[model samples]
Target chain A: MTTAVLQERTHYLNNGYGLKSWLLTKDHKRIAVLYFITISIFFALGGVFASLIRLELVTPAGDLVSSETYNKLFTMHGVIMVFFFLIPSVPATMGNFFLPMMIGARDLAFPKINLLSWYLLIAGGGFAIFAMMAGGVDTGWTFYTPYSTTYSNTYVIATALGIFIAGFSSILTGLNFIVTVHRMRAPGMTWFKMPLFVWANYATGVIQVLGTPVIAVTLVLVFCERVFHIGIFDPALGGDPVLFQHLFWFYSHPAVYIMVLPAMGVISELVSTFSRKPIFGYPFVAFSSVAIAVIGFLVWGHHLFVSGQSLYAGLVFSFLSYFVAIPSAIKVFNWTATLYKGSISYATPMLYAFGFIGLFTIGGLTGLFVAALGIDVHVTDTYFVIAHFHYVMVGGTVMAYLGGVHYWWPKMTGRMYPEGWAKLSALFIFVGFNLTFFPQFILGYLGMPRRYHAYPPEFQVLHVASTAGATVLAVGYILPAIYLAWSLRYGPVAGSNPWGATGLEWATPSPPPTHNFDRIPVVTHEAYDYTAVPQEVEVV
Target chain B: MSSEAHAHAEETLALREQFDTAEQQKDASTLGMWIFLITEIMFFGGMFAAYTIYRSAYPTVFAVASSSLNVTIGAINTCVLLLSSFTMVMAVRAGQMGKRNMIIIFLILTLIFGCIFLGVKAYEWNEKYVEHHMPGQAAFHLEGTPLQGPAKIFFSLYFAMTGLHALHMVVGVGILLTLIVQTRAKKFSAEYFTPIDISGLYWHFVDVIWIFLFPLLYLIDRHLPK
Candidate 1:
């Protein structure tokens, strides 16, 4: 106990004092906190926008706000949620905090670049906030040109610039992750011996590096078209607007993988740990992530099936889109098989992982419905499309993100959260999320278009249900914020390897030292080798 | 201690705490620069794809507008950029050989050629301004042009692509100036010249972009009817 106390005394939290230590920190863990705090604010702001959008839709009329305001609300909701919150949620915070620890490195390959990436996110957020303050952009998060470039009397350039700057931040983080994975692994840590979380992130990093720059250039063209009257995507000036969709979705579609792949990684960790078994078909799961990232790029044309593309092109894209789902199915099946006949525990993380699988399955299956030409003609730009993405992004990624946070909270804060409350919140989120989005699937099939302030009286019942569920889902999200914060002072001190996990991160002290490991770990076994005998040893 | 031993000690001092050895650090840095270059390719690749699609759609207008650009100046600037890239290569070689004076001299030469390329670009842009060929201005009007709309687009892309290349050149100059100051400060020796090598990579990359831009913009319709 004395030695545990001594180790705790010098951990990362108390190693330094004051704001400067935190703000200027080159430590990947501290940088993760910087990202965490910023993205949390973005989440709150996005949630407020979401709440307003829902409240306005609770009736058949636009009662709460003007139509323009409603449009701005959903636009900000998506812009803040997708770019500011979801994309950075897992990879920046958890990945940065844990990737080095998992690989047994003192720090990321380029610690200063990691810090710069966080700052770039903030600077980008500043531009976005400035644009919002100057009157928000109303072109929606897709920023489809013609409306965005030539017509919308909103702050399009400022918002696009914000997203553009943030793209560089993503690129730099991806670069850091790739190099770290390639060059920073400790001796004896072969590629397959590395944890699935690292593999998932490596795949996400590849997408970030290769896919983000295209968007950066795409937005640059948008900026030029707006500011300098470049004729790239404007039909009035002899350009094809369909080309805009092609280029935008070219990056933005793979961007969906960017948002979910890291969360899939977190779920891989949670399912294996809570089930007390190695992941089933580990190589298949690892390779599927890479497959998804690559295959994701070829399926963007599915978004444009209804956009006057050639009939033959749509057929090819539809076929490719169906092909992309095979890898995702493989992951889901592997996770389910990992649970069969295993010692499964319904920890809060496990509950949320279960939530992710159920919701992502519904989401992924519906993606095919839209990927088909005939069905997409009926459902594209409707609430069904909205519901489909929310399921995958919100239900899938956010659920895994929360679950991973709970599973790692003890290690992150050196304190155990209240398990009963955490599980209750998990249940709240699952039930509330279904209530929120499941009705929209029906509403969208009924031909209700999205981005509207008013709809038919028949749609009111579903919208009301979604609004009510949003309130519950909001509570589900807020509970973690309350308890996780409260646990810092009042909860039990969790020792290293509290769950008796097998990864190198668990080998260090809970709340690891400034340099992640006192001595670099040499890997000698495959990931999730739970059958090995245990012995307690000081990391240093 | 012998001078050789003293130099070995200095090399050890140059190693960072994060790396296990100098070789690993160098390899990581080189790989990182290569990855960054790939992103740059993708960044420019978007515009290239756009240009290709539009150019194929209106080949005659694109060729006519291509002829309007001064091929002589474009050809000269291309040569100038190629020379700068060659000098950058010499700078990297000098750094590898520990010839500090040669490194400095070659780097300055590269910087000079880069400036000359920019100066020629500014002069060409000035000529376009006088001829009312710049896009987005009220005075902008293409005269006696076939497919005026497509011709306008060709100029729009010409400016956007080359203008972006110029912006990269400006950034390159700033980086070279920093490297120059750092070299004078003796912050690097031959054993610790990763920054110089990476800068060489970036400089050569900028030249390669112009190599593509020169052909696509200046040489595309050289044989077309004036």
Candidate 2:
């Protein structure tokens, strides 16, 4: 369909008006918007905390705020960003909006449950926000034992409860995705015929379903130990603190995949579509997602290596951790190979994809460094670890998230953001993100531990550099928020397939109808069969 | 059958707008429930892992604490839950048979047994409270054993596991009550009983959790001397 025909059509956005239509709607597309709005608030809140944290670290002394406030700042930052923003970032927003459309389904299999997942996130986030406003939780986002269960004078229970409730939200979304992929695929859309994005999401769903409940129960144990003195993780009452680490990271390590795998899926799409080629080694990339989810489980013990976890167990864990990297490496190599000799474009989304590849490599490599018992002992609690995850989460996940958002913006909103501004922001984020995090690797190697409000004067230069990059990153993030909103009202109307992409979602009108397709599509081509896709003339 | 008649029958099947056919709807509902149950397993699995670890650490305390639980009431509650599971199946069968009255009767029966099990659980907990076996309470005291402190751990696990199970039972009761209302409203038929089937799956899963809870919480080291 042309842009003229699309202008007269009633899409999901115009389907209903007013708050009630949105708040009570069962449509997956509406629910995704609800998630987008909610997580955006959370992202802004998390970003504020990050800015405060960076500002504090810019000096050698903790002069800006008390140590306690600083502690709460980072804690809330970690909690909100990981649980509320990053984990749900791509999956809940882009994944939710597009998964059904890609699979040629009208909506997710469980639309009510899909809506309920959004509400659960709000309710869970409400408890967390309540905790934050009501004195704030300072036990750190990990909620390690003794401090969390026995000694911390904060809202540990409220925060943990919030996360506990949100775990169900993740589980429900995962459940919806799994069932949708299994039962709602269009005719002839076999498992392999589905996009890698769906496969990655399906893998993420498996982790969410299997792993989230453990953390939910772990948080419950933390709650019981704190309130009722259950003594599961409290060492004073014959409980093992190390067990808390085991249980926490069991879900949490896989949860790292939960955060990154969906981004990898997005990267897959961005790389292939922008490169004008099919994914290289599709089965390998597809299975690597499942591989990461499974191997991701066995490596949690690596977190406990310096914590008196048995030497043999640590050895086993360290080995398994290395194994997890192989699949990740396979994906990186495959994406790079997909780009080889292919007709590559420098779209804003493709730039983000390049950023994801470069930063995720650094993140994944540092993960291996930490996975090794010898290296982990040196830098386990240092700025190196912080830099490592920020590289993955902020660098990898956030970059791909933006890339996917930009790539699919037209399909989602029927408007193309200003190309020049979009590229400028992407450049700002790329340059800014690297500047912000890379110096931390040096400071960490020089022996600066994380979560400290003050540091020696020698670390100030690196901290200042890091803080400067953060300012630029902030500007980078803010740009999209401005332009995307602007584009919604004033940007050029986007035709159905702006990128000439090869997914079912793009086959429909921009801002697809409430029923998604006029008639259910039948898949007759391989994924990213760009040869059959008529190549549009390059708009220079 | 005429195409219009078949289409009307399909509509009467109550196939949701999302599903293409009744079988697809049935499959999706059943699959969704099974996946949810897997999550439930991991939820309880976390506690069970803690239990196994702590039990191994303090076998004597766990044995003593296990003995202190009222076996008679525990056994009786087990029987009650088993009977409830039976009634739940009967309700699902009634659903499939399209016996509206039988479905309601069986659901009510199952709900009653669920309540009876909970009522017995409350009585047992009250008895423990009187006996000072309740951990974390100021009056909690276990006399004459080196395992006194660890016995608190046992009681903590006891309350945690049983309390969580009881919470599930409460939710199960709520679900059954909703099914009862829906049944009364004449929502199910021979061709459309997916909700009833999935609810039965959930109820039975709760019952199965109790089956494990019964032996692990109540019957552990019962053969040991007092």
Candidate 3:
């Protein structure tokens, strides 16, 4: 298939060529690109922290560094990975770029506020960097009470403040997306007919708006306790530390959905496009996103099952946790059915999509083990829990993120990355990720507790294997960063509709013009209509 | 055929209109404001949930802590806030009716009431400070109180919850001041009063939060042990 001819259009990139233009720009696409770059840097920094952690664990003894340094390493890793990498990865980048175009709007409802979110992210990132430079915080990302409020000698306040500001950034983004999706749809594009990606983002936006603020307030309380010696979370002064956990997870648990839902949305598009089939049970998939968002809130107490919660309350949380999985299962099954006996392609994006399916399955199934009261008691803080979340968060969300990034790179930058290298990196990531995390599951089941600087000699084999996998995973992650950067200047021009996919974004020029469209499109066909052939001829 | 060409030109001229209709624009903006307000509710909802669980667990301490609160100041603040809401509504109505002077007048009235609310809050907080009721201070004691450790819990929550609410009030006042300036500049008209409407929604929301706080904090221990 040849590239189709589009109308001659003036490029937005050529319209401006200075830093000031980008800094002051209201263009959502540019803002998305800006987010992509900023988040990539933070991800690399976070990966470095992870590498230090894995390296320290390569041996049985705590010979690599003191326990204090090790604690700082994991703390920095968790904080950066959760806040800077996972939460903002897909939504700020892909959602910002495509949501407006998907709904036939020129820009978000409040473009200035949209820009303000970026500034907030930067300010927050700066505080985080400052904390790192000024002897990093050691209170693990959860900032579990007593430790965070009273024990930690590091700059907990600085880090917590950073996260608080970043939380507002997310809230603003959610607010923008909600308004855009609600009010900006093109004529005739009903909610049901909208693409599943939009549906997923909409659900995520809801969680972002509602769930993020709880964590913000919790962090504020933590900060106050630290600075003012307030006894909110300190048991010695009449504060209940358990209450802190309840409040923290109330947001953090749904935050996991905030991290994954967008990736799931990305997977829906990739599955349908590559399989050449309309998504099986589209409404189920769409509603499941909403269901997950709502159900996600009720089950946060599952994190407190072993934390001295009332037995009855624990049971309630445990049961609610099981119910949450039903919607997730529906999503996985629908994706599988979408791929059933269709004209399948082994494109790079599809490979990553396939990776997402396999890895997310392992990650999600293991979550059930942790949710079960008896099982969670045995492995609550062990490597088992670590492996379970990494499988879901890193293996699942990150794979889908890379897939979406590759899938949209052509449209986003008007350049195609090297397909062969892309496929090779995808394979390496799968192998390396499995190597790094899969053995942790064994180590966890064998009673190796997480967050320790030292361990018994018996766990060394799995530890070494995990460390080796981290090195490969590091390479796997770095390769795309190199090639994607290289592709921007030297690769062949990606004309509009590089993948021959069906979405409103594909209907416009690659690296879309500032106003998005010369005229708003009137939608007459449903999304993912890949079965029909086109009559228009290629320009090239 | 030439006559038909003239009719076609007339229709074509009308086809390139922006925004489908006025109602469409209004609906979109209104929906956007409501979604934003929902986010605000969620923001405060977190604090409320925390307050609820803690208060339920220690009803006696919460009541004793409530008894210490100056009901006169709190009630006055509440009335001031409710009246501010009324003034804000009138301001929005003035904007809608294209009455610029009335809009400014009511907005100013709303600002005054807001200041009055903050003033009462300051006096109440000062009273707590003077009485050594503030958390983490050396003056905190519960020997004679109905609830032992729970009184401290009550005061801890009391400061955190009301302090956060006061912080929001300050923010709202700043926003209203901005609206006042913008109103003076003639930025809003009958056709474009989104700012006023959204601000009113937010002001009313803050008022609603105080309503919940009053019952939870001020009225929880009104009938204390004699």
TM-score of each: 0.97, 0.98, 0.95
Tens-place lDDT per residue, model 3, A1-540, is 122222255666666879998998888888898999999999999999999899889888899889999999999999998998899999999999988888787777667778899999999989988999999999889999999999889989999999999998998898888877877788888898798999999999999988998898888888877776556677875668998999999999999999999999999999987887889999999999999999999999989878999999999999999999999999999999998997788889999999999999999999999999999999999999999999999988999999999999988877788988999999899999999999999999999999999999999999999999999899999999999999877666776787777888888888788878777888877778875434132311
Tens digits of per-residue lDDT for model 2, A1-540 = 345655587999889899999999988888998998999999999999999999999899999999999999999999999999988898899999999998999899999999999999999999999999999999889999889988899999999999999999999999999999999999989999899999999999999999999999999989988887766776766778888988999999999999999999999999999889999999999999999988888888988989999999999999999999999999999999999998899999999999999999999999999999999999989999999999999999999999998999888888889999999999999989989999999999899999999999999999999999999999999999999999887888887788878999988988899989888889999999986676553632
- Chain B TM-score for each model? 0.92, 0.94, 0.85
Span of ten consecutive residues with least summed lDDT in model 3 chain A: A531-540
Clashes by residue pair, model 1: none
How far off is residue A217 in model 1, in Å?
A: 0.7
Error of 2 at A447 (Å): 0.6
Which candidate leads the pack in TM-score? 2
The best-first sequence of candidates by TM-score reads 2, 1, 3
In terms of DockQ, the best-performing candidate is 2
Worst 10 residues of 2 chain B by lDDT: B1-10
lDDT of 3 at A356: 97
Alpha-carbon RMSD, each predicted model: 2.9, 1.7, 4.1
- Clashing pairs for model 2 are none
Worst 10 residues of 1 chain A by lDDT: A531-540
